[model samples]
Target: MKTRMLKIEGPRKLVLVEKELVLEDDEVLVRTLQSSICGTDKMYYRGEMPPNEKYPLFIGHEGGGVVEAVGSKVDEYQAGDLVMSFSRSCTFADYFKTKPINLQPVPEGLDMRIAALGEPLACAMHSVLESGVQLGDTVAVMGMGFAGQIMLQGARKKGATKIIAIDVLEDKLKLAKKMGADVTINPAKENLYQTIMGLTNGQGVDVVFEAAGNQDSLNACSAILKHNGHLVLYSWLTQPVTLNMHRWHQNSFKIITTTLVHHTKYERIVWSEKAMRPFQQGLIDVEPLISAEYKLADIKEAFEESVNNDEIIKIIIKP
Candidate 1:
Protein backbone atom coordinates (compact mmCIF):
# COMPACT_ATOMS: atom_id res chain seq x y z
CA MET A 1 0.00 0.00 0.00
CA LYS A 2 1.07 3.57 -0.64
CA THR A 3 0.96 6.12 2.17
CA ARG A 4 1.96 9.71 2.72
CA MET A 5 5.18 9.88 4.72
CA LEU A 6 7.31 12.85 5.77
CA LYS A 7 10.68 13.13 4.09
CA ILE A 8 13.29 15.70 4.98
CA GLU A 9 15.29 16.40 1.87
CA GLY A 10 17.68 18.52 3.93
CA PRO A 11 17.75 20.92 6.84
CA ARG A 12 14.51 22.95 7.18
CA LYS A 13 12.93 21.16 4.24
CA LEU A 14 10.04 18.80 4.96
CA VAL A 15 7.86 17.41 2.24
CA LEU A 16 5.18 14.74 2.21
CA VAL A 17 6.14 11.99 -0.15
CA GLU A 18 4.32 8.86 -1.25
CA LYS A 19 5.96 5.62 -0.21
CA GLU A 20 5.02 1.99 -0.77
CA LEU A 21 4.92 -0.14 2.38
CA VAL A 22 5.07 -3.93 2.43
CA LEU A 23 4.67 -6.12 5.51
CA GLU A 24 7.35 -8.65 6.23
CA ASP A 25 6.69 -11.98 7.94
CA ASP A 26 7.95 -10.63 11.26
CA GLU A 27 6.43 -7.17 10.96
CA VAL A 28 3.12 -5.44 11.65
CA LEU A 29 1.33 -2.69 9.78
CA VAL A 30 0.08 0.18 11.94
CA ARG A 31 -2.48 2.82 11.05
CA THR A 32 -1.19 6.06 12.44
CA LEU A 33 -3.47 7.56 15.09
CA GLN A 34 -1.35 10.27 16.68
CA SER A 35 2.12 11.64 15.97
CA SER A 36 3.97 14.44 17.73
CA ILE A 37 7.05 16.61 17.29
CA CYS A 38 10.17 15.95 19.35
CA GLY A 39 13.26 18.00 20.26
CA THR A 40 15.35 15.77 18.06
CA ASP A 41 12.87 16.32 15.24
CA LYS A 42 13.26 20.06 15.65
CA MET A 43 17.04 19.67 15.68
CA TYR A 44 16.96 17.77 12.42
CA TYR A 45 14.37 20.10 10.98
CA ARG A 46 16.36 23.24 11.87
CA GLY A 47 19.70 21.89 10.63
CA GLU A 48 21.20 21.91 14.12
CA MET A 49 21.98 18.23 13.74
CA PRO A 50 22.16 17.29 10.12
CA PRO A 51 20.46 14.01 9.33
CA ASN A 52 22.98 11.33 8.62
CA GLU A 53 22.62 7.99 6.87
CA LYS A 54 22.50 6.08 10.17
CA TYR A 55 20.24 8.02 12.56
CA PRO A 56 17.19 10.28 12.36
CA LEU A 57 17.60 10.50 8.60
CA PHE A 58 13.91 11.15 8.00
CA ILE A 59 12.93 12.67 11.37
CA GLY A 60 9.74 10.80 12.42
CA HIS A 61 9.38 8.68 15.61
CA GLU A 62 7.15 10.25 18.28
CA GLY A 63 3.82 8.51 17.60
CA GLY A 64 1.48 5.60 18.34
CA GLY A 65 -1.01 3.76 16.20
CA VAL A 66 -3.27 0.73 16.06
CA VAL A 67 -2.24 -2.51 14.44
CA GLU A 68 -3.96 -2.61 11.07
CA ALA A 69 -2.48 -5.99 10.14
CA VAL A 70 0.05 -8.42 11.53
CA GLY A 71 2.45 -10.52 9.53
CA SER A 72 2.35 -14.31 9.34
CA LYS A 73 4.99 -14.85 12.04
CA VAL A 74 3.51 -12.32 14.46
CA ASP A 75 1.18 -13.88 17.04
CA GLU A 76 1.83 -11.67 20.04
CA TYR A 77 -0.13 -8.87 18.32
CA GLN A 78 -3.11 -9.08 16.03
CA ALA A 79 -5.29 -6.71 14.08
CA GLY A 80 -6.71 -3.75 16.03
CA ASP A 81 -4.12 -3.98 18.79
CA LEU A 82 -3.31 -0.61 20.30
CA VAL A 83 0.44 -0.21 19.86
CA MET A 84 3.17 2.40 19.71
CA SER A 85 6.40 2.27 17.80
CA PHE A 86 9.15 1.26 20.20
CA SER A 87 12.12 1.09 17.90
CA ARG A 88 12.94 3.59 15.17
CA SER A 89 10.67 3.43 12.15
CA CYS A 90 9.68 6.66 10.40
CA THR A 91 6.20 7.16 11.90
CA PHE A 92 5.02 10.57 10.66
CA ALA A 93 2.73 9.07 8.13
CA ASP A 94 -0.78 7.69 7.67
CA TYR A 95 0.52 4.14 8.06
CA PHE A 96 3.80 2.29 8.35
CA LYS A 97 5.09 -1.25 8.88
CA THR A 98 7.69 -2.46 11.36
CA LYS A 99 8.85 -5.55 13.24
CA PRO A 100 6.57 -6.88 15.97
CA ILE A 101 9.40 -6.52 18.45
CA ASN A 102 9.38 -2.80 17.75
CA LEU A 103 5.71 -2.41 18.70
CA GLN A 104 4.65 -2.01 22.34
CA PRO A 105 1.05 -2.39 23.49
CA VAL A 106 -0.28 0.66 25.33
CA PRO A 107 -0.74 0.21 29.06
CA GLU A 108 -4.14 -1.18 30.14
CA GLY A 109 -5.66 2.10 31.37
CA LEU A 110 -3.53 4.76 29.69
CA ASP A 111 -5.45 6.93 27.27
CA MET A 112 -4.37 6.71 23.64
CA ARG A 113 -3.58 10.43 23.67
CA ILE A 114 -1.01 10.01 26.45
CA ALA A 115 0.26 6.66 25.22
CA ALA A 116 0.60 8.19 21.80
CA LEU A 117 3.56 10.09 23.22
CA GLY A 118 5.13 6.71 23.88
CA GLU A 119 8.87 7.26 23.65
CA PRO A 120 9.07 10.72 25.22
CA LEU A 121 6.77 9.98 28.15
CA ALA A 122 8.48 6.70 28.83
CA CYS A 123 11.88 8.35 28.74
CA ALA A 124 10.96 11.08 31.23
CA MET A 125 9.12 8.75 33.63
CA HIS A 126 11.90 6.19 33.48
CA SER A 127 14.34 8.86 34.57
CA VAL A 128 12.15 9.70 37.59
CA LEU A 129 11.57 6.04 38.57
CA GLU A 130 15.31 5.37 38.54
CA SER A 131 16.29 8.84 39.72
CA GLY A 132 16.69 7.79 43.37
CA VAL A 133 14.11 10.40 44.36
CA GLN A 134 13.06 9.28 47.80
CA LEU A 135 10.49 10.52 50.29
CA GLY A 136 11.22 14.03 51.59
CA ASP A 137 14.16 14.45 49.27
CA THR A 138 14.52 17.86 47.67
CA VAL A 139 14.49 17.65 43.86
CA ALA A 140 15.02 20.08 41.01
CA VAL A 141 14.06 19.64 37.36
CA MET A 142 16.18 21.92 35.17
CA GLY A 143 13.68 22.30 32.38
CA MET A 144 9.93 22.89 32.15
CA GLY A 145 9.42 21.55 28.65
CA PHE A 146 7.44 18.39 27.88
CA ALA A 147 9.77 15.89 29.55
CA GLY A 148 10.65 18.27 32.38
CA GLN A 149 6.99 18.82 33.24
CA ILE A 150 6.38 15.08 33.43
CA MET A 151 9.55 14.55 35.43
CA LEU A 152 8.48 17.25 37.87
CA GLN A 153 5.13 15.49 38.37
CA GLY A 154 6.82 12.14 38.78
CA ALA A 155 9.27 13.51 41.31
CA ARG A 156 6.42 14.98 43.32
CA LYS A 157 4.56 11.65 43.26
CA LYS A 158 7.76 9.93 44.38
CA GLY A 159 7.49 11.88 47.65
CA ALA A 160 9.87 14.72 46.99
CA THR A 161 9.44 17.17 49.84
CA LYS A 162 10.53 20.22 47.86
CA ILE A 163 10.21 20.15 44.09
CA ILE A 164 11.84 23.06 42.26
CA ALA A 165 11.02 23.70 38.63
CA ILE A 166 13.68 25.62 36.67
CA ASP A 167 13.34 27.20 33.26
CA VAL A 168 13.88 30.58 31.63
CA LEU A 169 10.33 30.68 30.39
CA GLU A 170 7.81 32.09 32.88
CA ASP A 171 4.95 30.38 31.12
CA LYS A 172 6.54 26.98 31.72
CA LEU A 173 7.32 27.90 35.32
CA LYS A 174 3.68 28.85 35.81
CA LEU A 175 2.58 25.50 34.45
CA ALA A 176 5.14 23.88 36.71
CA LYS A 177 3.35 25.28 39.72
CA LYS A 178 0.08 23.68 38.61
CA MET A 179 1.91 20.43 37.96
CA GLY A 180 2.87 20.08 41.64
CA ALA A 181 6.15 21.91 41.92
CA ASP A 182 6.43 23.49 45.33
CA VAL A 183 8.69 26.18 43.94
CA THR A 184 9.31 27.45 40.44
CA ILE A 185 12.56 29.21 39.45
CA ASN A 186 13.02 31.23 36.34
CA PRO A 187 16.78 31.45 35.91
CA ALA A 188 16.35 34.29 33.47
CA LYS A 189 14.94 36.47 36.24
CA GLU A 190 16.60 35.25 39.41
CA ASN A 191 20.06 33.89 40.06
CA LEU A 192 19.50 30.13 39.78
CA TYR A 193 22.33 29.08 42.05
CA GLN A 194 21.57 31.60 44.80
CA THR A 195 17.84 30.93 44.65
CA ILE A 196 18.24 27.16 44.81
CA MET A 197 20.87 27.48 47.51
CA GLY A 198 18.51 29.61 49.60
CA LEU A 199 15.66 27.14 49.05
CA THR A 200 17.83 24.21 50.12
CA ASN A 201 19.45 26.16 52.98
CA GLY A 202 22.84 26.16 51.19
CA GLN A 203 23.09 22.34 51.22
CA GLY A 204 21.81 21.94 47.63
CA VAL A 205 19.18 19.54 46.32
CA ASP A 206 19.43 15.77 46.51
CA VAL A 207 18.66 15.20 42.85
CA VAL A 208 18.68 17.51 39.82
CA PHE A 209 17.17 16.43 36.51
CA GLU A 210 19.04 18.02 33.58
CA ALA A 211 16.12 18.20 31.19
CA ALA A 212 17.03 21.50 29.57
CA GLY A 213 20.10 19.94 27.98
CA ASN A 214 22.41 22.92 27.59
CA GLN A 215 25.66 24.20 29.01
CA ASP A 216 23.96 26.79 31.19
CA SER A 217 21.44 24.36 32.69
CA LEU A 218 24.19 21.79 33.13
CA ASN A 219 26.34 24.31 34.94
CA ALA A 220 23.44 25.43 37.10
CA CYS A 221 22.63 21.83 38.03
CA SER A 222 26.22 21.16 39.00
CA ALA A 223 26.45 24.25 41.18
CA ILE A 224 23.33 23.42 43.22
CA LEU A 225 23.79 19.66 43.54
CA LYS A 226 24.39 18.25 47.01
CA HIS A 227 27.77 16.81 47.97
CA ASN A 228 26.58 13.45 46.70
CA GLY A 229 23.58 14.01 44.46
CA HIS A 230 21.89 12.35 41.53
CA LEU A 231 22.17 14.12 38.15
CA VAL A 232 19.69 12.44 35.86
CA LEU A 233 20.51 13.30 32.25
CA TYR A 234 17.24 13.07 30.34
CA SER A 235 19.25 13.71 27.19
CA TRP A 236 19.76 16.83 25.01
CA LEU A 237 22.40 19.54 24.81
CA THR A 238 20.83 21.35 21.88
CA GLN A 239 24.05 22.43 20.14
CA PRO A 240 26.95 20.45 21.59
CA VAL A 241 27.40 22.13 24.96
CA THR A 242 30.57 22.26 26.98
CA LEU A 243 30.72 20.75 30.45
CA ASN A 244 32.34 22.42 33.44
CA MET A 245 34.29 19.66 35.14
CA HIS A 246 35.30 21.43 38.40
CA ARG A 247 32.17 20.87 40.49
CA TRP A 248 31.42 17.65 38.67
CA HIS A 249 34.53 16.16 40.24
CA GLN A 250 34.45 17.88 43.64
CA ASN A 251 30.74 17.35 44.28
CA SER A 252 30.97 13.60 43.53
CA PHE A 253 27.59 13.80 41.79
CA LYS A 254 25.96 10.62 40.53
CA ILE A 255 25.16 11.15 36.88
CA ILE A 256 22.23 9.11 35.65
CA THR A 257 21.14 8.99 32.02
CA THR A 258 17.72 7.64 31.10
CA THR A 259 16.38 7.39 27.56
CA LEU A 260 14.07 4.39 27.22
CA VAL A 261 14.18 4.33 23.44
CA HIS A 262 17.94 3.64 23.48
CA HIS A 263 17.59 0.22 25.08
CA THR A 264 16.52 -3.24 23.89
CA LYS A 265 13.00 -3.74 22.59
CA TYR A 266 12.03 -5.91 25.57
CA GLU A 267 13.38 -3.27 27.94
CA ARG A 268 11.43 -0.55 26.14
CA ILE A 269 8.23 -2.58 26.40
CA VAL A 270 8.67 -3.48 30.06
CA TRP A 271 9.92 -0.07 31.14
CA SER A 272 7.27 1.75 29.13
CA GLU A 273 4.47 -0.09 30.90
CA LYS A 274 5.96 0.69 34.29
CA ALA A 275 6.85 4.25 33.34
CA MET A 276 3.39 4.99 31.96
CA ARG A 277 1.46 3.35 34.83
CA PRO A 278 1.09 6.66 36.67
CA PHE A 279 -0.46 8.27 33.63
CA GLN A 280 -2.79 5.31 33.18
CA GLN A 281 -3.95 5.53 36.80
CA GLY A 282 -4.54 9.29 36.44
CA LEU A 283 -1.82 10.19 38.93
CA ILE A 284 -0.33 12.17 36.07
CA ASP A 285 -2.29 13.92 33.34
CA VAL A 286 -0.69 14.59 29.92
CA GLU A 287 -3.53 16.71 28.61
CA PRO A 288 -1.76 19.94 29.46
CA LEU A 289 1.45 18.71 27.94
CA ILE A 290 -0.28 18.58 24.57
CA SER A 291 -0.25 22.27 23.76
CA ALA A 292 -1.60 22.05 20.22
CA GLU A 293 -2.79 19.68 17.52
CA TYR A 294 -2.50 19.90 13.75
CA LYS A 295 -3.53 17.82 10.79
CA LEU A 296 -0.86 15.75 9.11
CA ALA A 297 -1.28 17.69 5.88
CA ASP A 298 -0.26 20.84 7.78
CA ILE A 299 3.00 19.19 8.71
CA LYS A 300 5.29 22.06 7.83
CA GLU A 301 3.19 24.46 9.84
CA ALA A 302 3.62 22.23 12.87
CA PHE A 303 7.38 22.20 12.45
CA GLU A 304 7.34 25.95 11.95
CA GLU A 305 5.39 26.44 15.13
CA SER A 306 7.97 24.43 17.01
CA VAL A 307 10.53 27.00 15.89
CA ASN A 308 8.38 30.08 16.43
CA ASN A 309 6.93 29.14 19.78
CA ASP A 310 8.91 28.08 22.82
CA GLU A 311 5.76 27.86 24.92
CA ILE A 312 4.40 25.12 22.70
CA ILE A 313 4.99 21.92 24.65
CA LYS A 314 3.96 19.02 22.42
CA ILE A 315 2.27 19.28 19.02
CA ILE A 316 0.33 16.24 17.84
CA ILE A 317 -0.47 15.60 14.18
CA LYS A 318 -3.39 13.41 13.22
CA PRO A 319 -3.42 11.91 9.78
Candidate 2:
Protein backbone atom coordinates (compact mmCIF):
# COMPACT_ATOMS: atom_id res chain seq x y z
CA MET A 1 0.00 0.00 0.00
CA LYS A 2 0.98 3.65 -0.50
CA THR A 3 1.22 6.28 2.24
CA ARG A 4 1.46 10.04 2.05
CA MET A 5 4.61 10.70 4.05
CA LEU A 6 6.51 13.86 4.95
CA LYS A 7 9.94 14.41 3.45
CA ILE A 8 12.27 17.21 4.51
CA GLU A 9 13.47 18.06 1.00
CA GLY A 10 15.75 20.73 2.44
CA PRO A 11 15.96 23.33 5.16
CA ARG A 12 12.61 25.09 5.73
CA LYS A 13 10.95 22.74 3.26
CA LEU A 14 8.41 20.00 4.02
CA VAL A 15 6.60 18.07 1.32
CA LEU A 16 4.25 15.09 1.55
CA VAL A 17 5.46 12.40 -0.80
CA GLU A 18 4.01 8.99 -1.70
CA LYS A 19 5.73 5.95 -0.17
CA GLU A 20 4.99 2.33 -1.05
CA LEU A 21 5.01 0.21 2.12
CA VAL A 22 5.50 -3.52 2.24
CA LEU A 23 5.19 -5.21 5.63
CA GLU A 24 8.05 -7.40 6.81
CA ASP A 25 7.47 -10.69 8.58
CA ASP A 26 8.08 -9.18 12.03
CA GLU A 27 6.36 -5.91 11.30
CA VAL A 28 2.97 -4.34 11.98
CA LEU A 29 1.04 -1.90 9.80
CA VAL A 30 -0.55 1.06 11.56
CA ARG A 31 -3.18 3.45 10.25
CA THR A 32 -2.18 6.64 12.02
CA LEU A 33 -4.96 8.38 13.90
CA GLN A 34 -2.96 11.14 15.55
CA SER A 35 0.57 12.56 15.70
CA SER A 36 2.23 15.77 16.82
CA ILE A 37 5.37 17.80 16.20
CA CYS A 38 8.24 17.47 18.68
CA GLY A 39 10.92 20.00 19.59
CA THR A 40 13.42 17.75 17.80
CA ASP A 41 11.21 17.76 14.71
CA LYS A 42 11.41 21.53 14.76
CA MET A 43 15.22 21.31 14.68
CA TYR A 44 15.22 19.06 11.61
CA TYR A 45 12.53 21.22 10.03
CA ARG A 46 14.86 24.20 10.43
CA GLY A 47 17.89 22.20 9.11
CA GLU A 48 19.97 21.88 12.33
CA MET A 49 20.43 18.22 11.49
CA PRO A 50 23.17 16.10 13.08
CA PRO A 51 26.55 15.99 11.37
CA ASN A 52 26.00 12.44 10.11
CA GLU A 53 22.36 12.91 9.08
CA LYS A 54 21.11 14.58 5.90
CA TYR A 55 17.95 16.10 4.44
CA PRO A 56 15.32 14.52 2.14
CA LEU A 57 14.48 11.95 4.80
CA PHE A 58 11.45 10.76 6.77
CA ILE A 59 11.08 12.91 9.91
CA GLY A 60 8.61 12.11 12.71
CA HIS A 61 8.61 9.81 15.74
CA GLU A 62 5.58 10.55 17.97
CA GLY A 63 2.15 9.17 17.06
CA GLY A 64 -0.31 6.34 17.59
CA GLY A 65 -2.95 4.52 15.55
CA VAL A 66 -4.90 1.33 15.08
CA VAL A 67 -3.28 -1.73 13.65
CA GLU A 68 -4.37 -2.05 10.02
CA ALA A 69 -2.44 -5.23 9.40
CA VAL A 70 0.37 -7.37 10.79
CA GLY A 71 2.94 -9.55 9.16
CA SER A 72 2.84 -13.34 9.37
CA LYS A 73 5.57 -13.55 12.00
CA VAL A 74 4.06 -10.82 14.17
CA ASP A 75 2.23 -12.33 17.16
CA GLU A 76 2.32 -9.45 19.62
CA TYR A 77 -0.09 -7.33 17.53
CA GLN A 78 -3.04 -8.10 15.29
CA ALA A 79 -5.37 -6.09 13.09
CA GLY A 80 -7.53 -3.51 14.89
CA ASP A 81 -5.32 -3.23 17.96
CA LEU A 82 -4.73 0.33 19.12
CA VAL A 83 -1.01 1.09 19.38
CA MET A 84 1.24 4.05 20.09
CA SER A 85 4.38 4.58 18.04
CA PHE A 86 7.78 4.68 19.74
CA SER A 87 10.15 4.92 16.76
CA ARG A 88 10.77 7.00 13.63
CA SER A 89 8.82 5.39 10.80
CA CYS A 90 7.60 8.64 9.20
CA THR A 91 4.49 8.83 11.38
CA PHE A 92 3.53 12.13 9.70
CA ALA A 93 1.62 10.20 7.12
CA ASP A 94 -1.51 8.20 6.34
CA TYR A 95 -0.01 4.91 7.47
CA PHE A 96 3.32 3.39 8.36
CA LYS A 97 4.78 -0.02 9.20
CA THR A 98 7.25 -0.94 11.90
CA LYS A 99 8.47 -3.81 14.00
CA PRO A 100 6.20 -4.76 16.91
CA ILE A 101 8.99 -3.68 19.22
CA ASN A 102 8.50 -0.06 18.13
CA LEU A 103 4.72 -0.15 18.64
CA GLN A 104 3.24 -0.05 22.15
CA PRO A 105 -0.25 -1.26 22.97
CA VAL A 106 -2.54 1.49 24.24
CA PRO A 107 -3.64 1.09 27.81
CA GLU A 108 -7.22 0.12 28.46
CA GLY A 109 -9.69 3.07 28.51
CA LEU A 110 -7.04 5.74 27.85
CA ASP A 111 -7.95 8.36 25.25
CA MET A 112 -6.41 7.57 21.89
CA ARG A 113 -5.49 11.22 21.54
CA ILE A 114 -3.27 11.01 24.62
CA ALA A 115 -2.04 7.63 23.51
CA ALA A 116 -1.04 9.16 20.18
CA LEU A 117 1.48 11.28 22.07
CA GLY A 118 3.13 8.18 23.47
CA GLU A 119 6.80 8.97 23.03
CA PRO A 120 6.89 12.51 24.40
CA LEU A 121 4.43 11.90 27.19
CA ALA A 122 6.33 8.83 28.30
CA CYS A 123 9.61 10.69 28.22
CA ALA A 124 8.32 13.59 30.33
CA MET A 125 6.74 11.25 32.84
CA HIS A 126 9.96 9.28 33.13
CA SER A 127 11.88 12.44 33.72
CA VAL A 128 9.53 13.37 36.52
CA LEU A 129 10.07 9.96 38.08
CA GLU A 130 13.80 10.46 37.86
CA SER A 131 13.38 13.95 39.35
CA GLY A 132 14.13 13.74 43.08
CA VAL A 133 11.11 15.63 44.30
CA GLN A 134 10.31 14.88 47.87
CA LEU A 135 7.13 15.83 49.68
CA GLY A 136 6.82 19.55 50.37
CA ASP A 137 9.83 20.37 48.20
CA THR A 138 9.78 23.42 45.97
CA VAL A 139 10.23 22.69 42.26
CA ALA A 140 10.33 24.74 39.07
CA VAL A 141 9.82 23.84 35.43
CA MET A 142 11.75 26.08 33.02
CA GLY A 143 9.40 25.78 30.05
CA MET A 144 5.63 25.47 29.74
CA GLY A 145 5.47 23.57 26.48
CA PHE A 146 3.78 20.17 26.16
CA ALA A 147 6.39 18.17 28.06
CA GLY A 148 6.91 20.91 30.62
CA GLN A 149 3.18 21.25 31.24
CA ILE A 150 2.91 17.54 31.85
CA MET A 151 6.02 17.66 34.03
CA LEU A 152 4.44 20.38 36.17
CA GLN A 153 1.50 18.13 36.93
CA GLY A 154 3.71 15.10 37.40
CA ALA A 155 5.89 16.99 39.85
CA ARG A 156 2.82 17.69 41.92
CA LYS A 157 1.98 14.01 41.84
CA LYS A 158 5.52 13.31 42.96
CA GLY A 159 4.84 15.56 45.97
CA ALA A 160 6.27 18.93 44.99
CA THR A 161 4.44 21.34 47.26
CA LYS A 162 5.25 24.47 45.31
CA ILE A 163 5.34 24.11 41.53
CA ILE A 164 6.76 27.13 39.78
CA ALA A 165 6.36 27.26 35.99
CA ILE A 166 8.48 29.71 34.02
CA ASP A 167 7.87 30.80 30.44
CA VAL A 168 7.97 33.85 28.19
CA LEU A 169 4.50 33.25 26.75
CA GLU A 170 1.54 34.32 28.87
CA ASP A 171 -0.85 31.71 27.52
CA LYS A 172 1.41 28.81 28.41
CA LEU A 173 2.05 30.19 31.89
CA LYS A 174 -1.69 30.71 32.30
CA LEU A 175 -2.40 27.14 31.24
CA ALA A 176 0.35 25.96 33.54
CA LYS A 177 -1.34 27.73 36.45
CA LYS A 178 -4.68 26.20 35.57
CA MET A 179 -3.20 22.73 35.38
CA GLY A 180 -1.30 22.67 38.70
CA ALA A 181 1.37 25.35 38.94
CA ASP A 182 1.25 27.20 42.22
CA VAL A 183 3.22 30.05 40.65
CA THR A 184 3.84 31.08 37.03
CA ILE A 185 6.66 33.42 36.18
CA ASN A 186 7.06 35.18 32.87
CA PRO A 187 10.74 36.07 32.91
CA ALA A 188 10.20 38.22 29.83
CA LYS A 189 8.17 40.69 31.86
CA GLU A 190 9.00 40.24 35.52
CA ASN A 191 12.17 40.05 37.60
CA LEU A 192 12.54 36.25 37.77
CA TYR A 193 15.41 36.24 40.30
CA GLN A 194 13.67 38.49 42.79
CA THR A 195 10.33 36.76 42.47
CA ILE A 196 11.76 33.28 42.71
CA MET A 197 13.85 34.22 45.72
CA GLY A 198 10.82 35.78 47.41
CA LEU A 199 8.67 32.74 46.75
CA THR A 200 11.30 30.28 47.95
CA ASN A 201 12.06 32.40 51.00
CA GLY A 202 15.65 33.07 49.80
CA GLN A 203 16.64 29.39 49.63
CA GLY A 204 15.67 28.46 46.03
CA VAL A 205 13.95 25.45 44.53
CA ASP A 206 14.91 21.93 45.52
CA VAL A 207 14.83 20.85 41.91
CA VAL A 208 14.60 22.65 38.58
CA PHE A 209 13.66 21.13 35.21
CA GLU A 210 15.23 22.62 32.10
CA ALA A 211 12.41 22.05 29.63
CA ALA A 212 13.25 24.83 27.18
CA GLY A 213 16.09 23.84 24.89
CA ASN A 214 17.98 27.15 24.85
CA GLN A 215 20.87 28.90 26.47
CA ASP A 216 18.74 31.37 28.40
CA SER A 217 16.48 28.76 29.95
CA LEU A 218 19.45 26.63 30.94
CA ASN A 219 21.10 29.62 32.53
CA ALA A 220 17.95 30.50 34.43
CA CYS A 221 17.56 26.95 35.68
CA SER A 222 21.10 26.95 37.00
CA ALA A 223 20.66 30.31 38.71
CA ILE A 224 17.56 29.26 40.72
CA LEU A 225 18.44 25.88 42.15
CA LYS A 226 19.42 25.42 45.82
CA HIS A 227 22.87 24.06 46.65
CA ASN A 228 23.21 20.33 45.90
CA GLY A 229 19.73 20.30 44.38
CA HIS A 230 18.66 18.11 41.49
CA LEU A 231 18.89 19.67 38.03
CA VAL A 232 16.76 17.51 35.77
CA LEU A 233 17.86 18.10 32.18
CA TYR A 234 15.05 17.33 29.71
CA SER A 235 15.71 19.43 26.62
CA TRP A 236 17.60 18.21 23.55
CA LEU A 237 19.36 21.44 22.56
CA THR A 238 20.63 20.73 19.04
CA GLN A 239 23.01 23.66 19.06
CA PRO A 240 26.03 24.42 21.20
CA VAL A 241 25.39 26.74 24.12
CA THR A 242 27.81 28.59 26.40
CA LEU A 243 26.93 28.36 30.10
CA ASN A 244 28.39 29.92 33.23
CA MET A 245 29.83 26.84 34.92
CA HIS A 246 31.01 28.40 38.19
CA ARG A 247 27.80 27.62 40.07
CA TRP A 248 27.69 24.02 38.85
CA HIS A 249 30.68 23.10 41.02
CA GLN A 250 30.51 25.83 43.64
CA ASN A 251 26.90 24.94 44.43
CA SER A 252 27.47 21.16 44.13
CA PHE A 253 24.50 20.56 41.77
CA LYS A 254 23.46 17.01 41.02
CA ILE A 255 22.81 16.93 37.29
CA ILE A 256 20.39 14.26 36.12
CA THR A 257 19.79 13.23 32.51
CA THR A 258 16.52 11.41 31.86
CA THR A 259 16.32 9.96 28.36
CA LEU A 260 13.81 7.11 28.53
CA VAL A 261 14.34 5.45 25.14
CA HIS A 262 18.07 5.24 25.73
CA HIS A 263 17.28 1.99 27.50
CA THR A 264 17.11 -1.41 25.86
CA LYS A 265 13.98 -2.10 23.79
CA TYR A 266 12.51 -4.36 26.48
CA GLU A 267 13.23 -1.78 29.15
CA ARG A 268 11.72 0.96 27.01
CA ILE A 269 8.55 -1.07 26.46
CA VAL A 270 8.19 -1.84 30.16
CA TRP A 271 9.00 1.71 31.28
CA SER A 272 6.75 3.31 28.69
CA GLU A 273 3.78 1.38 30.05
CA LYS A 274 4.68 2.43 33.58
CA ALA A 275 5.13 6.06 32.56
CA MET A 276 1.74 6.18 30.81
CA ARG A 277 -0.28 4.80 33.73
CA PRO A 278 -0.62 8.15 35.51
CA PHE A 279 -1.77 9.82 32.31
CA GLN A 280 -4.17 6.98 31.59
CA GLN A 281 -5.70 7.22 35.06
CA GLY A 282 -6.27 11.01 34.93
CA LEU A 283 -3.51 11.89 37.36
CA ILE A 284 -2.04 14.14 34.66
CA ASP A 285 -3.84 16.23 32.02
CA VAL A 286 -2.85 16.21 28.33
CA GLU A 287 -6.08 17.21 26.57
CA PRO A 288 -5.63 20.89 27.26
CA LEU A 289 -1.96 20.92 26.31
CA ILE A 290 -2.98 20.16 22.72
CA SER A 291 -3.55 23.70 21.50
CA ALA A 292 -4.19 23.08 17.78
CA GLU A 293 -4.75 20.46 15.10
CA TYR A 294 -4.13 20.25 11.36
CA LYS A 295 -4.70 17.71 8.65
CA LEU A 296 -1.85 15.79 7.04
CA ALA A 297 -2.19 17.67 3.75
CA ASP A 298 -1.84 21.00 5.57
CA ILE A 299 1.43 20.14 7.33
CA LYS A 300 3.31 22.98 5.66
CA GLU A 301 0.93 25.49 7.17
CA ALA A 302 1.03 23.60 10.45
CA PHE A 303 4.82 23.73 10.63
CA GLU A 304 4.75 27.41 9.76
CA GLU A 305 2.28 28.17 12.53
CA SER A 306 4.17 26.07 15.05
CA VAL A 307 7.44 27.83 14.27
CA ASN A 308 5.99 31.35 14.49
CA ASN A 309 3.61 30.89 17.42
CA ASP A 310 5.08 30.82 20.94
CA GLU A 311 1.74 30.21 22.66
CA ILE A 312 0.91 26.98 20.88
CA ILE A 313 1.72 24.25 23.41
CA LYS A 314 1.17 21.30 21.14
CA ILE A 315 -0.18 20.92 17.57
CA ILE A 316 -1.71 17.59 16.59
CA ILE A 317 -1.63 16.26 13.03
CA LYS A 318 -4.66 14.22 12.03
CA PRO A 319 -4.30 11.66 9.27
- TM-score, each model? 0.95, 0.96
List of clashing residue pairs for candidate 2: none
Instruction: Tell me the spans in candidate 1 whose CA falls farther than 4 Å from its real position.
Output: 50-56
> Model 2 compared with the native: what TM-score?
0.96
Clash count, candidate 2? 0
Cα lDDT tens digits for candidate 1, 154-263: 99889999999999988888889998899998888889889988988899999999898778888888889999999888866546667787877888889888888777
lDDT of 2 by residue, 1-319 (tens): 8999999988888889998999988999999999999988988988888677887889889999999999999999989999999988789999999999988999999989889998999999999998988999999999899889989999998889999999999988889989989999999999998899999889889999999989999999889999898999999877788998788899999999987877788999989989999988889878888889999999999998888887788899998
Q: What lDDT would each prediction earn against the true structure?
A: 0.86, 0.91
